[model samples]
Target: MGDPAAQALCAALRDRDWRAARDVLVTVTDPDDQAFCMYAAGRVPDVQEWIGEWADAEPRSTLPLLVRGTHAVHWAWQARGSASASRTREEQFREFHRRLTFAENLLDEVAGRDADDTTARAFLVTAARGRQVGRDEAHRRFAEVVARHPWHRLAHAQMLQYRCAKWFGSDEEMFDFARTAAAKAPAASGLAHLVASAHLEIWLRLRSGEDNRYLQQAEVRAEVRAAADHSVRHPQHGRYAGWPTPHNMFAMAFAVGGDHAAAAEQFRTIGDQVTELPWAYAGNPVRVFRKWRGKVTDSVA
Candidate 1:
C-alpha cells in the first residue's frame, strides 16, 4: 500500500517536482523514511501527526516512538525563544524544558523494552541536549548506538550535533568524529556526508563576514570536496535510504562556498526535497534553497 506511492514520491523528489511532492509523501510508511521526506518538504507537523497515528496504531513499533522523540525535540527547540525575547523567554524555557523532558522519557521507555533500538539511542542524544544533560551522557548514548550500527546516518548526524562546541564539544572533537565516521563507513554508504555536515555547523557558528573565508579555507574546502567525491558524486554511489537529505546538505555547502557548479550538481541530485535543518540556520530554507538553485541554474545556463 505504501511502497508504490513512496517510490513515486522518491522519484518526484529526485526530479525536484515540488507540486506533486505532498500528495506522494502521504503514501510513505516507514516512520523515519517518511519523516525524512516530509522534513525535506517542510511538512513537519504532518509528519509528526502521521507518526503519532502510527504510534497509536502500532504501539509496539519502536520506529514511531523514535520519530516522536525527534519531533518533540524540534518543537522544544522552537519553544526556546530567541535572545531578543526578554518578556516571554522564561515561559518559553519552561515549555522547552517540558517538551525535552517528555521526549527523553519517551526514549527511555523505548530503551527499556528494546535495548537494541539504536534509533532510539541516537535520538536520546538530541533529547539529552535539549534537557541540558551532560555531554558525557550524550556521548554514552551515541556510542551505544554507533557500536551497533556503525554507519547509521541519522545517528551520526545526531552525534555530530552533540559533539558540536555549542553543545560542549570542541572544534577538534567535532571534526575528528566527522573524519573518523567517514573513514569507517563503507564506500557509497553516504556516511561521508558527515564531513560536509561538520563544515556547515562550523560555517553557521562563524561570524557573518567570516563565513565566506571560513568556507574557502584550504582544509574546509578539501574536506567538503572529499565528502562529495566519496558520497554523492561517487561513480558507484548507491541510492541509500534517506539519500536526498545528504545531497541537500552538500548542495547548501557548495552554494555557500561560491562553488555554484558543485552546488548545481548536488541540487540536480536532490531535486525538490528540502529539509529544515542546516538550511534553517540561514533562514527560511525553502527560500534559501530556491535562491541558490536559481543562482546555480543561471551559472550553468
Candidate 2:
C-alpha cells in the first residue's frame, strides 16, 4: 500500500511467502533503502505471528532477524500506545519494555554476528530509545552505525529522536546534533532533514499557541530555508526511493513556519505523496496532510 518494496514484502508476509519477501529485501543494499523497506514491512499486521518462523528458518542470514527486530519496535510502540509515559498504564509500560528488550536482543545478535551490519546497528539506535539506554550508550550505538554508513539516514533520525526534548536530550542537544550533522554531511544527501526534524520537535513540544510562534520565528524560518538549500533545493539532489519524506518534512516545516510560498514549493514536489511521519506527529495522517496541503495548493482538501 506504500513503497513498492513494502507492498511486495507485505504481500509476501500476508501469503506466508517468506522466500519471496527475502528475495525483495536482499536486493536492497543501501542502508537508507533497507531501513525504509524494513519500516514499511514492519507496519504490516500479524507479522509477529510468522516473522519468528522466518528468523528460525534462516539461522545463517541476518535479514529475518533484522525484520523481526524492526517489527519488534513497532510492536513495542503498539503495546505502549501513543500516549505520553504519564498517561500509559503500568501494564503497557511493562509490555513496551519487554518487547523492546526482545528487539534489542535480536539486533545485538545481528551486529555481533556481522560487525559491519549497518542496518542492525541503525535499528539498535531505535531500540536504545525505547529501552532508555544511557546517554553514553546511545552515542556509542549511533557511532557504530555512522562509522559503517556515515550518511545513514535512519540511524541519524533514530538518534535524533532519542536526543529529542520529549525523550532523553534537551533542546540545546537536539539543535547541536541536527546542525552538526547537517554541516558535516555531504551536499545532495538529505541530512538537512535533521534540522527540520529538530525544529518540528521543538514546535511540537511547546504549548498550542507558543508552538506556532516558535515555528514563525525569524531564525527558525532562516534555518529551515538553509536546511532546504542543503537538501531538496540542491541541484545534485536526485530523487531516491524515500524522496517524498524530505519534501513532506520540509513542507510541514515551512507550512508551520509561515512561509506559504516555500511550503508551496515543497508541497508541489510532494504532489500526492504523504509519508506517515511529519504529519502523523500532528493528528490523523490523511486529514493533517490534506489540511496543510490545502493551505498551500488550495486543491487537496
Candidate 3:
C-alpha cells in the first residue's frame, strides 16, 4: 500500500539511507507514494537525477511538486550568501509563491469531494505563508479549518505557532493556548518543539523588560530552551526542515537577553540559507533583525 511504502521511505530518510529509499520509492505507483518518494529525493544530496525524473513525470501534480518546490526553496535560501544576494532571492520567492498559489488552487478542485483533506492541506499551504504576510488572515483561516476538523494536528499546531508569534490576544491567553497545543502534539514529529519554540520567542519578548511578570516563569524558559535544543538536535524532524524560524527564534531570544552580538551571529548563519519554499519569512532574519534593531534602539533610548 501507499501508506506502507511512504512509511518505509520516511524511515529510510530518518536512517539516512537515501539510496535504498529512492529504490523503494521507484516501485511505488500510487500518487501519494510517488509524492513521498519525490519528497525524499529532494532531501538527499546530488539526487538531481531522481528529482528530474520525478518532476518531469509528475509536473502537474500538486503534492509531488510541492515537495520539490519546498526543497528548491531550501536550496535557494541556503545559497543566499548575503542580503544583497542579487535577484536569486527574489526569483526563489516568486517561485515559492507560485507553487503555494498552485497548491491553493488545487485544494479548491478537491474540496467538493474531500472537504476535510482539502481543508487540512490548504491549512498547511497557508500556514507556510503565515511566516510572510497574512499572519492574522492565516490564523483566521487555520482556525476555521481546525474548527471543521479538530483532529488535524498540523493545522492546530500551526495555528498555535502563528498566534504565539503574532500575539493574537493577551499574554495569559496566548500562553494557555500554546501550552495546550504543545501537549496535544505527537512528540516524535516535533510539532511540540515547534509550538514551544514559538512560545519561547513570545516569552523572550514579554520578558525584554525587567518589570515583565512572565520573566520569572521558570517553566516557560525551561520549555523554550528545551524546544530549541530539540530542534537543533533534529533539524529535519518536521515537514519543513532548514526553515529560518528556529534559527531566527534563537537569535531573537539572545537579542532580547541583551546579547546583540550573539543575535547578529545567529541571523548571519541563516543569511545564506534560502527561504523555505512557500517563502514564509514571517519570521525570517531580515524581518527579525528589523524588529530586533528597533527593540534594541528602544531599550537604549
TM-score for all models, in order of appearance = 0.77, 0.95, 0.42
lDDT of each: 0.71, 0.86, 0.47
lDDT of 2 at 215: 92
Local accuracy of candidate 2 as per-residue lDDT tens digits, 29-66: 77788888887777788888888888788899988998
| TM-score ranking, high to low | 2, 1, 3
Candidate 2: pairs in clash: none
Q: Which is the winner by TM-score between candidate 1 and candidate 2?
A: 2
- Which regions in candidate 2 have their CA more than 4 angstroms from the true location? 298-301
Q: What is the lDDT ranking, best to worst?
A: 2, 1, 3
> Roughly what TM-score does model 1 have, to 2 decimal places?
0.77
Error (Å) of candidate 3 at residue 24 is: 6.8
Model 2: worst 10 consecutive residues (lDDT sum)? 292-301
The better-scoring model by lDDT among 1 and 2 is 2
Clashing residue pairs in candidate 3, if any?
76-274, 77-273, 77-274, 77-275, 78-273, 78-274, 131-282, 132-282
lDDT of 1 by residue, 179-285 (tens): 99788776567878889888988888889989868887777777798888888888877664567777888898888887778898888877777766668888898
Every model: Cα RMSD to truth: 6.2, 2.0, 11.0
